[model samples]
Target: MTAPVFVVEGAVPGDGAYVLDGPEGRHAVSVKRLRAGEAVVLTDGLGAWCDGVVTGSEGKDRLLLDVGPARVEDEEQPRITVVQALPKGDRGELAVETMTETGVDAIVPWAASRCITQWRGERGLKALGKWRATAREAGKQSRRVRFPVVADAASTKEVAKLLAAADFAAVLHEDRDAPSGALASAELPTSGEIVLVVGPEGGVSPEELAVFEEAGALPFRLGRSVLRTSTAGTAAVALLLGRTGRWG
Candidate 1:
């Protein structure tokens, strides 16, 4: 099996050495039991990764890694951002985790009319932080050099503003009259960003749908059956990644 990967900040070729700190450091030393001189890969989560050799442990909290030449992957295709409606309980967390593994470029928590979860004060930040951590872990497991971003929670109106600023946007709806089938039908921008809006358990209200429609977000259907919030975003990401030729 391949050695477990870990993320680090500001890793570069010729930097010679770096420290793996925080929870990631603990995982490398305590969890993986990597010894000095073992080869591992470190990424800055921006398409750059370096094969490094562990020098030694610095106490129980840090691991010293000697950096080497940087290797960069081809730039990802048009960024795909998923604006996921807040699901009840831990379903939203599952969506974030799965989307990360599927190579989504960013995640946005949406508070729609039917959303059962509300982000209040620090709770919102905490939730976003948790999602970001989840994304980071998933990216490492998938051996992705770039980590997907998790955005702060936003209401439907605020999400509309964010979508309007994107180069391409689509809203997933079960409406039979939707103009497109899956994301493949829509003409994706070849060199710009794409944002996908997913609804909650109870589904998007007509008002919220109208806002997205007016914002130029074409409504699309995944299939005939309605999928759970957790499943929908992940399925959508898979399709988008495949269509964009990122499913390598």
Candidate 2:
């Protein structure tokens, strides 16, 4: 099996001995029970990583490692970003977690018109922190060398601007009457940015849809059945990963 992964604070500093300490060290020594000779990986959560074998431990807080060279994985092509309308309760974090594991490069938390939960002041900031934390944890769990970024929450007008800047933009919608198509049939971008929008439980408001349309984000569906706001982004990402050769 691959070595268990832990996060460090900065880029790897070349082939040498490195100390795995502080909170990460505590997790390694006490929680993971990492001992001398056990293989482990460390990352900065921004593409830089190193693989090493544990060499020793100091108390219950630090672990030493005899690591080889540090290397970085290139950021994936057709950088995928999800514009997720905030879900009610903890589902927002769930959405962030799964999408990170599925290889989403970045996430934009959207405050859509129909969203029941609003991000305002301290509570909003706390919730955003949770989403970012979930992404980091999930990225490590998936053995991803590069973690997804959770951007600050976006307003409807801001979301439209993001859509306008993407090489390809899609919004997950179920309206059979409106002009929409399956995600499988859309011409996915190969090199530039690709943005997909996932609406809230109450769905995207019609007026907001018009704004996104004007910004060039096409409405697309996954299949006949509907998916929750939390899960739709993951499924869409999986499909894009497969089609765009990112999974290769």
Candidate 3:
């Protein structure tokens, strides 16, 4: 198996040594029980990483590491961004986690008109924090050098703007007459941002659908059966990855 991955605040890849401390260090030592001389990888979550071995423990929550040469990885082409409408309770975090692990480059929380969950003030901030934390943890577990970004909640208008800026954008809807086609059939660019918008549990409103399509976001369907709001984005991303040759 590959060495377990960890995230550091900042990284100088070529440096001969580095420290793993604080909460992550504690987890490595106490939870993972990483002993001295075990191999590990540390990343800055921006494509820079260093492979290293634990030299010794400085304290309960700290480890000194002897790092080898550092290297920077190139970001993948046709970067994928998922605009996921907020789901009820912890379902939002579930979507974020799965999407992150599935190779989404970024995630945007959407507050659709029909959304049952409304985020405001402290609640919204806390929820956003949870999404970020989920993405970070998922990235570590997936051994990703570049972690997905969890963007702030987006209103319908903001989501439209994002769709307009994307090279290719698709809005997932289940309508039979919505000019819907299989997501797998869509033509993706070789490089650039590709955005996928998923509506809430109540689904996308007609007015919202019009706005998205008007912004050049084509309405697409995943398959014959409809999926829950929490998993739709993840499935759509998988299709995109395959279509763009990222999965191969």
Candidate 4:
């Protein structure tokens, strides 16, 4: 069986002995019921990871492990980034979790014009925190040493800027009159960043589409079916991954 993965604050470089503690350690010891000699994986969630065997537990939330064979994974090519428009309710977290598992390099919470939900003041900060946490947990579950970066919530103007900077960009919209063809038709770049823009449930406004288009974001439909805001980003990312041979 594959060793269970855990997120650690940091891992020792090279082969060495290290102590794991804090909330994650507690979860490993108490919640996961991990005992001494169990094999596990620890990651800093920034491409640094090590395999370890638990030596013992040191009280609550503490586990000692002898770690070795550190590895630093380089970022994947044609790095996929999803500009996900805010979804209502916990669906926002749903988006973050699945996208992370699908191997997206980054996720941007777009505050599109038609979003039913609004994030303001303390609520916005808290929501952003939830997205980050979801990404972190999903990354561990997927055994990823490199977690996706959850960018701050962005306005349409900000998203435009992102599209402009991207090597390739696409807006997932099911517009029958859209001049662009299906997303599969677009040439997937093998290097640099590719950004996929997913709009809200109510859909992207005309003004927003124009802005994205002006910034070089082409509009393309996923398929004949319409998907909810929560599921759209993940599906789009998966499609991109398949096209780029990342799924292979």
Q: In TM-score terms, which candidate is top? A: 2
**Per-candidate TM-score against the hidden true structure:** 0.88, 0.97, 0.96, 0.96
How far off is model 4, as Cα RMSD? Answer: 1.5
Write candidate 2's Cα lDDT for 1-248 as tens digits: 88988898877655778888999899889998988899988889899988899999999988988888889889889999999999999999899989998899999999998999999999999999999999999998998889998999999999999999999998898663544336887778789999999999887888988999999998888887889999999999999999999998
**Shift of residue 133 alpha carbon in model 1, Å:** 1.9
Best by lDDT: 2
Each candidate's lDDT (Cα)?
Answer: 0.82, 0.90, 0.88, 0.89
- 1 against 4, candidate with superior TM-score: 4
lDDT of 1 by residue, 138-200 (tens): 889888888888878878888888789889888888763764455767667765788999998
Model 3, residue 245: displacement in angstroms?
A: 1.0
The weakest ten consecutive residues by lDDT in model 2 span 174-183
- The per-prediction tally of clashing pairs is 0, 0, 0, 0
Give the least accurate 10-residue stretch of model 4, judged by summed lDDT: 173-182
Clashing pairs in 2: none
Select the stronger candidate by TM-score from 2 and 4. Answer: 2
Candidate 3, 136-194: lDDT as tens digits: 99999998988998988989999999999999998888773544446777788999999
lDDT of 2 at 77: 97
